[model samples]
Target: MSKLRLVHCLLFFTAICILLPPIAARGGHSDYIHPGDGNSSFHGIARHLFAQEEPRPSLELTRGYMTNDDLEKAMKDFTKRCSKISRLYSIGKSVNGFPLWVIEISDRPGEIEAEPAFKYIGNVHGDEPVGRELLLRLANWICDNYKKDPLAQMIVENVHLHILPSLNPDGFSVRKRNNANNVDLNRDFPDQFFPMNEDLALRQPETRAIMTWLRNTRFTASATLHGGALVANFPWDGTEDRRKYYYGCPDDETFRFLARIYSKSHRNMSLSQEFKEGITNGASWYPIYGGMQDWNYIHGGCFELTLEISDNKWPRAAELPTIWDYNRKSMLNLVASLVKTGVHGRIFSLDQGKPLPGLVVVQGINYTVKAHQAYVDYHRLLAPGQKYEVTASSPGYKPRTTSIYLGDNAVTADFILIPEASSRGKLLRSNCDCSCKNCGQPLLAQFFPETNNGITLTLVVVVVFLCFLLQRRVRYNLWKQKQSSRRSITV
Candidate 1:
């Protein structure tokens, strides 16, 4: 081939290679894999040239692992065992028709109230089963320690916690990352920057189930579990350029604070030598399109984190208890952070004293928290020990903003908006009480009670209009006089 032709061919091949998914997330997650043969992929050969930084310990996948049927049975038993504070329900079914079970833990299990609700989604990737296992253990632990443990009692009575242990049970059964149809659930949501996942029909059943769940329920904040790296990941998960860089969402500080809480609470997550605080912005680490983390924050109004709890995605079943113990504090602190911090309140209309479904936003933060449709209530999560200017807005009504020092306690930041059209109506209502008999009485009668019938309102209005016209005519005459004087030719 000629040199020019060879150059063109080489450039095309390079573009294709760059676009292909990684064999596995380098030392992180392996979300993408070779479809035909998993062994077609391999870790970087450089590990052979240089000693591997971290040795891979022997992992026995089936030793203590629960099968799909066993997990379902465990969930069913938990509901029966702790029927008062927990209820077992299915959000939707997976592609294989396996019911996507959820265990809701609250004092009033399914009743809707003013309290905030949180959700924990696990096993997004079929291969990462640790999250699913840990979640079931969390539910059982809470049940075992309900009022006996302070934190457990607080979560049960104050917050509505929903736990979906396995979203991709079919994938878990097959021991792969993708679901039965081979669509990666993490990359299957509707993206704001791209249209690849926008077509609803193209979405997987698991993705549709999550989308429908968010629509029916309002979650204050949530977290999804994954494995590969040990760090707390926050949004915006993807960047506009699709390049690797630190791209923070509007609520960067708040997300960082939240991530720090989880890491610090964990046994040794905060001691990580790779990540600074054992927390990273998703885009900073790597950019993935159609990620659930960004979609939850954008569409569902839920502050979500992608947590990589273990270096090995599938650790030995014997290590499961140790892993759960390491993550227990982080999980509890994250859920407790919902009720322990931030500002929450309902928006109201000034005229009718009714609720207004307005938006709550922090001044410097670009994110918006939406009020619930039923009660017009909003829950905004922010880091404590800071002064923030919070604003609330709605259509056709004036937006209201206020500054408050949000301490450790949850501050009630309610707003009352005045509709734009109400000004004229209020003025008219003030002028006359809409009484026919009072039509002839001047509005000034309120100032002078004895002149109640002295000057008819109609006569007063005519006199005022006549004075306005006369004043305008006098001004015109003065202008004509000045113009004529200035235009007159010198004699």
Candidate 2:
């Protein structure tokens, strides 16, 4: 081999190494979406051919927006910086294999506690990237101010806040409204009145991830962010006849209350002329079937709201700061609402004072909230300044009802249920009252008016029996805990 030829070969290999890295990086980070990958249906082609094309701004509008990879890094960085109060995890992956990262913020991050859990999911529609940006801001704001700010501190100490910045990273990468498969995720959940999205096999991976997440984590309430409008929308997102009118769920008043919390806190959302008080019922605004908001309520036992934060979709990147400012308070207050104004408590059986994973029902609201299996704690969100008859019951136990006048602050009303065996009610009546007036107190101080000896004997026997039952119950629960592997749903 000639010396000159050897030098030329060395130069060629060096050039290949230098150029390949940049080419690979560009391919990995590019936001470009192939038209073929986006749509292949005849309907899609026909619509494109006949429909007039609307003017779309160049990618310049997304100049300051974080790419999918950048967003993933931001979440990781946040968790590291705020490791004391935050944990980073993923619900699932997008069609393009982008991790759906979630940032969980709490005083005790990743550890189960008797606290209400709330989630904020943004960027359901890829084009509506404002939510994703604002959600990141929300997490950062909470991290920065949790130590000094009362609202942030309360949320961190009392509630488990999960923030998923972008649910549709694939669509966002392409600046489209749908996912990579060209399906609208907001309309991809199971519907109450329709069976179109009832097939699990046909469900998108993004939708399935959300469904599985909810099943695993007991979210008390949640809200998704969007763009193209400015109003807080709450469920019955659809109707049986597909008509557009005021269609409400059984918890209409509660939903309205929850929606108002966001709209009223926004800088100018409440001043909107279109939606009254900057809030609208989903069906009343315009019926949409298989909406995530409705499915969250119906299937997941979570009250969810669809919030349209901006009038312009894909606004200039420079406007993100101002938009975040407008929504900062609304976001903080909505999370704080979980701990500030609600009915939260645990249920226990009188026999052994064991936590009973029972059902909590509020009178006049045709919905039942179940207590956490581990802690038996339930968080029921209700509008403040109202009287509610809360009833807690479990199988084989006598239900107890208590009236609470929920004021501006939250109320904790625990229940001690009695077994429904014959003569058990009469025997336990003196010690089985709920957290109402004179709870669990002896109605008869003296079993016999004349004999103090009889009352003393009765008390001694009851205490002995209760002590035995309590010991047995504790041992049984410990054995079950050792044998069974149960998923922990943070209260």
Candidate 3:
């Protein structure tokens, strides 16, 4: 080869290396959809999309949007910084090699082994990304401000928060709606529908990881986050048939209470209202089979909820400030409510009044009307010989609730919570003032003296602006270097 030709090739290769650094840094040809208009500012596009017409009180707590990479870093940073408060672990790995990370935040380390723990997961779907951001914010907020904030202190001190910030990491990496295998992890559970050609049961690693965690952890109350809807979807989601829509199948009253807590948290976004106006009610809405919520309820015997965060397909980054405003308080309320109640029971029936094994009973006592769901594991703690105000329900029988004292930590409480002969009970209007319409009453109002320690929303705005400045500076430096290299090559 001629020396001139060699020189030309070397120069071309150098130019390529200099100009393509951004592409290289972005993880190699991944289709990460940034929220932007005209391909300029993804953040601006996100902001405009989630922009609320009427300002809400709670929408001001978000500081900024974290990219997938940033989120990973934040998780690492949090665990490292607050090692005293949290323990980070990889539940599994995504198809893209990102760890499915879970940060177990607690005041007491041994509590998880001793007592039943509650779990909260965010960003199961890649599109609904706010929960991932929010959970991080919540974790950070609690760690930073717990000493000053009573609510934060109470939560960390009491309940052990097992948070999975990003469940569908493969989906998150590519910004796809489903996992890398094109399977919706939510619908990939081992249920009655399993072995059917359509079901992706135990197929995806993500599903397997979550299922394994549930089997191992013994979670009391759990929730998964999604978007493109504005309601908290509870169990029996597979069916819309009213005939099969009674509160509880095996445990009527307990299901009702669970449903009530979910409803309360979201200010009572009614199933009827959701069906009338929400996305899932539409004929065009994607129908999922063998989802996580149903499997959790039936197989795991865990009370779980699917919290649909936003109505937008991809909520705008710019609107995150506003979105967090509405969500932060509601999230806090939901977590706080879970630890408030003491005695929770679910009434059920047995064949010839015999004790049925593996029955779930939830008893809610000192019920205060609140708009958030409280966390309780009525199933695992129930013993053979303990006294419980039980509401027993089983499939193909009349639902029943009764008071019984058991013997020697035994399993199974059999009582018939009378099922309505017809599904004609007057729909009671929720008297709750809390966010969720179905929550009975605010437990905080009863116990902790209410204080006007409003969240420092202003701090969030300042932090967000600082993040914006930092990002802009980084982009500017990259752009400047690219321009300089282009000029040099031209000369």
Candidate 4:
């Protein structure tokens, strides 16, 4: 053969050598001997490298636990049984289309009140079914004893308590740690430091439902139940640098106080040997990204804690009763803490005595607690035995600050904001009657004579039209002056 032909053949052989191994590997197992055939070391190494997750636990393991349908029935039954104080609602559906049911327990359920709100979420992880069971118990216990038990009665009357029994019903059915889409719901929320999970379209249904639910309801404090650990975990869940260290949010001390309420009230959570005082800061223990605990605090203005109630991820169904017994007081106390320890108040306008829907902020803390729009009520949770300078402010009004020595009980600190001088003049103009101030006649009635009934009606229409033009002219002048001022500043 010629030299060029020989060279071409050599290049083709080299290309075949480079690609043949992978092609043959994909073609058939006959090309390669199985590591499991004889060599124990190769078999072990291969198995370890490509190991799959453990099989989903059989339904037999969840025999005594309530299924998704059973939970829905139980929630509906509880609402029917205690219709006077409870309401059953669905926030949204899961990946598998299971309704995310929530039971609201309050004296005036479904009605917005000045009272603070609290929420408890169970079964964030599908395999950690303990919280879901315990939450049902919590609801029934309140329904059965609210008439006699003061704690239960207090929760029913003073606070709007929302309990979500299962956030990951799809995962719970399959006994997996993630939702039906295999996305970990806890880690699917938008992160603070990272832009990951910012696209709402890409978010999991479970996380989106939670984000939407929080937008509708204003919760002062909340907790989610999980297993495989026993402690109260609080934000900041993840650090900015992604390092494992103690990172706390703006209300770190207040969060610690809230977490301790659950830890100390528990039968033996505070006695844990692993976690100090059975309360661990999330980042201190281990930093995790996109956790719901931090997102609630940062975005929704809700203080949320991740409560690991059981050491075993999936304890026997027979042990659930004991687990509930251990956590019942803790859960109740945590809910009661919203009413017992916070600095609660309403913000009003001094001129009109109307609700201002203002903001309540403490002097030293960086966080701002917003008052409700309807009631203008604000619930600020703080550590007891501390003096705080609480300030309430609103647009077009002067802010008012008050200092209070909060004791063991909640303190009411209502604020009445005074309008600014310019704002007061505008308010006066807006509320002024469309009549002559000096003479007791309509402002523009003088322009027309009082002749017949037809002329009188015509005069009224003309006066109203003139007043509308005057108001529009006044607003346009203000806008013009504002634009002029901006131009001067830019120049």
Query: Which candidate would rank higher by TM-score, 2 or 3?
Result: 2
Q: Mind giving the per-residue lDDT tens digits that candidate 2 earns over 170-253? A: 988887767887677876787777566656776789999999999999999999998878889898877777667899999888
How well does candidate 3 score on lDDT at residue 406?
Answer: 46
Model 4 TM-score? 0.77
lDDT of 1 by residue, 339-444 (tens): 6778876676543345678888888887888898887877889988899988999886789888878776667666767656553343111122222344334323
After superposition, candidate 4 runs with Cα above 4 Å error: 1-55, 423-491
- Model 4, range 176-273, lDDT digits (tens) per residue? 87788766677678778655556677678889999999999999999999887789989987777767789989999999999999999999999989
Q: Could you tell me which residue pairs clash in candidate 2? A: 115-491
Best prediction by TM-score: 2
When sorted by TM-score, best at the front, the candidate numbers are 2, 1, 4, 3
Which candidate would rank higher by TM-score, 2 or 4?
2
Poorly placed runs, candidate 1 (over 4 Å): 1-60, 419-491
How do all models score by TM-score? 0.77, 0.79, 0.55, 0.77
lDDT of each: 0.76, 0.78, 0.51, 0.78
Assess candidate 2 and give its lDDT.
Answer: 0.78
What are the per-residue Cα lDDT tens digits for candidate 3 across 1-491?
A: 69999999999999964653121000011111121122334323322322211221122232345767788899999988988888888888877778888888777643442223667788776645777877887788778987798777656765667888888777665565567766556545653332221323426788778878876666666777666556655545443321223232343334444444444554434443534322121111222344677678666656676666666635557876666666666566556544443333223221121122223344653221111112212333232324566454444445444565543322322232222333542222212222222233221122223343323333432444344334433633532332221111000
lDDT of 2 at 192: 76
Least lDDT summed over 10 consecutive residues: which range in candidate 2? Answer: 23-32
Clashing pairs in 1: none
What RMSD does each model have against the real structure?
Answer: 16.2, 13.9, 25.1, 15.0
